[model samples]
Target: MKTIAAVMAASAFLAACGSDEADDETTTPDATDETSEETSDDSTDESTGDTIDYPDLSGETIDVASDWSGAEQANFEAVLDYFEEQTGASVTYQSLGNNVATALGTQIEGGGAPDIALVPQPGLVDQLVDSGDIVPVTENVVAQVDANYAETWRDLSTYDGELYGVWFKAANKSTMWYNVGVYDDAGAEIPETWDDFMSTLQLVSDSGVPGLVVGADVGWPLTDWFENVYLRTAGADMYDQLAAHEIPWTDESVVEALEILGDLWGDETLVLPGGAQRSFPDSVTAAFTDPPEAGTVFEGDFVAGNIADQTDAVVGEDANFYPFPSINGSEPAVMGAGNVAIAFNDDEATMALMEYLASPDAANIWIELGGFTSPNQNADTSLYPDEVSLAIAEQLTSAETFRFDMSDLTPSAFGGTEGAGMWSILIDFYQNTDDVEGTAQALEDAAVAAYGE
Candidate 1:
């Protein structure tokens, strides 16, 4: 198997940026406007003059569970529909909302778990594996994953040296979305370093609008901001150590990253009126809406979807994104998040769905529909709806270094739980930016408890 870095390097050469003409002709699709019936008819194999003899699953039913809702839920159901079309299977999708981890755990314990689920956290994968309910993927699914995905994705989905899931969706979290009109009006160029980023924000603040708006109410967004800074400041070695609890959170490197965040978050004038209380979707829209409330919002590439759906702003024109600025003169790093498809049952219907998801053919269905990206190297990039989405896809495949979200990697008691663990600690830090040492110490204490270190 190739190293993840090498895999990404090799895949980068295969990707080309889409044309401006294609971008100009594209608009974000309304989730309600498209239906599963519309999507299942299009097949990648048929387009290339090839045919697949799918298993005859006429009477089989497969149930899938995930935390997605609204537009995301609709988009994924379209992919499921394509599987239903290929094989004569009836696939049912259930949205478990924000508490999917807990809910899925209960279902598995009581022997009522869905056939398969799209899990968002690797830590949860470990927990599920330990419960002895998760079935190792079939050999056919393994071959598809080996052929289509990067080693990093495969590694993340494996537990105890056995592959248990397939990564179906990916996120590039190292992005800062800005209002184009506000940036041009403030005469600010895209910042390349931490100092320059702050200067740009200051300039925007001087131009009568707040410099940034953060949706810190849920706290995971703050974790992303910290992870990007930490990856650049401390480097990947220490990042891996900290994530595994091999290093304390009170380490100086952690403190430095928090202090960098404090430079923007600590200030009252630099943030929108609600400060840390704003919702993530509202913050994304506020940055691009008319008479914008803030100059920029920082989050994952998925922010573009919210801007398109909630507000009427044009994605590549009225709203755009730049890479998160380098911190402490470190090399560029990409922080990402993804959903892994794990099976709870090894039934024939479950195996078929898993294999299809691992194939590029299944990925292209969602990619063409808009607001989706994939780690599958063979996934067609040209199917991306616009230049913004295309650029994000390129970033995911081409980065010199990439790491999954830190919070998602740690134990739920420390990272994944709501109103507790990393979420609550970061929220408290956002409200009290002066408590830098306290925040670091609090995180370290939580890690000790969660990791039993």
Candidate 2:
């Protein structure tokens, strides 16, 4: 959680640039620690014999566990510190470093899992929910988030008809970022359609500036393209179909999306020299810094925070944002990385902490700390660190539709295979731009092999 400020900044500087389905029957088996007896549906209160024991903060101590570190950790501590002051509950904060899932399981078995824990990845949420490692949050907490955050977030947080966790910050992935100065100098118009966008890329490439620089090695940035294409061509339902294993990867839409991406990669103007080899974190540097820099790239809302330390480029004016253009003037679609808090024990202290974290005020605290776009629908936009972030907050506020990461919606095995397939398709496409049909077939074949026909 070092924030990888510089690393993310460099990647964010790239448009600048800019799930799921499935039935319980067809779902991947839950992979969390088998030791966990608690399921997401479990509602037993350990402190009350058999009843849910609400925490009476008079002299109780609650421990919280997470992977948050550096600024992220500090911000969370601040939130908890404030919570302690208000509730008179003494709290201990523990940072478990990187091995969170394993540690949480061990600690939980030992009766330790901290009172409240932050589960960052969605796949983990699914596993945790199934294993009873975490329980559904209370109705009040759900209500608080519903009132403040966007519906897309609520939908993502809710699984199998119950609210298992409440998200504090959600990363919006359907975004493109560009250098204001570069655009101003070239008089290039921001692209609004997929064709227009490609044309603009050609124009920028023709201008002899780095047209687009993406760190393909990161895998996630490359994912941004597939997500957008899936939305543009197949729409959400189809996208969901792919995620749920309902549609084979060789479907027409999947093939077309790969071809389009291949075209983008084939363009010499799109990538910086050696960009194909760069990691996603470092690609941003190639795009923004002097000499061999790019004019545009694609990324997510968190890109701003990642870039906050580099190049004095302010958020609103120096940096600006636009949604991933309509694939064909269709509704704007978005992919999100949502973070959640799960409740395992139904004890009072745990419930109170859960309630506090999901509260509108807590959501606002997260926005002010500057790493997320709160999922709480009512979070105050004014609290965002900068204009660009505030603008994103507004977009989240008005967003009519949103989807979680496609790879995250399925089992890790499926997501990993799909991600690897995407990279393979992109690398092949980049090398064979002229062979669109061949490349498309190859991509389709690869996807089918990965997920089966």
Candidate 3:
């Protein structure tokens, strides 16, 4: 797929802030007559609009709650520092550090909510929406974002037709990360159909290397597989229905996808049984640490960062990616993962920063730091500066259809329920292939119980 390139240039200076004592300011937006409709950039000016000028905020601290760990977290802090220098709005980051959803919920309940929170998971966004604790980007704000990012991200970040968050660093998960050397040795081409894909796997296995490695221990990874299969097997509409809680799990299309996965699980030549014990973080090890072990892994682009320390396999050079093949020439399924900005204050300066952050400038900053695909349409992909990341960014830009993580978009509870159900399905298929129908029924029953439909 051809991607629209991002216009990358040297970082430009933004306006500065001038305040010091800014503290816990968690007042909801005045719910009086809030009007939200998609507006173009012409209607919303970055130079002059309803945005407030940079306030004099030198030491004034705004709490930013997050769950970023390792290099990603460090990079995030650097970005925050950029914002701080420009706005003079010093950030006292309250690292949620781990278990973001739980920690943020605790702070919200305890009445010590941060002014800015980083919601990395969609389930948390759903919860915040349900609680009315989140505020949408004001009309002026949405216009600013719309001018910068692709409309698709705005649609995804918006809940119930209201823009609630600013999206950043999105990576398309409908990708298959493969071992190039292994493929070269096996003399294989990337598959484009289910039969072709199966044949490739068989060919790889025939060469005595595991054809694939998937991590199910994290639960969400399993959802990734399910979403990819659902999109390929049942098509996008059905996948959306499943996402919106409008489709029953027992739907024949869903069952057929599950059955195919079951068959794959039964094929011992396909993947190592060790994959069942690996989590998302451990998937890199299980899949592509070295040859003679595992060959390919189905995961998101972020997996690149995880394996960087283990292998010198650069993105486009040593490693390559392809979208998960469709079952029967259906359109591809694209999944996204990233953080959304949720605000707790409505001050003019705060709102201005929020609006600006949603603009093309912020997108540039994100891409420069090797941030994932920005939903920002104005963002120049070259900011990624790396060939491989740039390729992934282009993949995101050209994607015809996109959805958030399968588990995170679903009700929080179902991630555990349906995820465990799928695991059982895999185990069942491994033990007794004839039990596919029974396991499918079990999954449907479990889904019905989870959603009460």
Q: What does candidate 3's lDDT look like per residue over 340-391, in tens digits?
A: 7878776655565676567555554545555355655555444464776766
Each prediction's whole-model lDDT (CA): 0.78, 0.61, 0.61
What TM-score does prediction 2 earn?
0.71
Per-residue lDDT tens digits of candidate 1, residues 1-453?
112233233223322211223322221222234533343333333222322336778999999999887667877888887678778899999987655677887787798999999977777787778878788998878878877666766766766678899989888899889999999999988998989999898999999888899988878888898999999999877877788787899999999999988877988778886756887878988898888989999988888778877788898999999999988788767888778899988899999899888876777777777677777666666678788998887776667677777887787778877777888899999998899999999999999999887
Q: Write down the TM-score of every candidate.
A: 0.88, 0.71, 0.77
- Tens digits of lDDT, candidate 2, 177-253: 87776766667798889888887766777777877877765254666677777777887677766765566666778
Residue pairs with backbone overlap in model 1:
none
Candidate 2's displacement at residue 48, Å, is 30
Whose TM-score is greatest here? 1
Q: Residue 226 deviation, candidate 1, in Å?
A: 0.8
Better of 1 and 2 by TM-score: 1
Ranking by TM-score: 1, 3, 2
The number of residue pairs in model 2 that clash at the backbone is 27
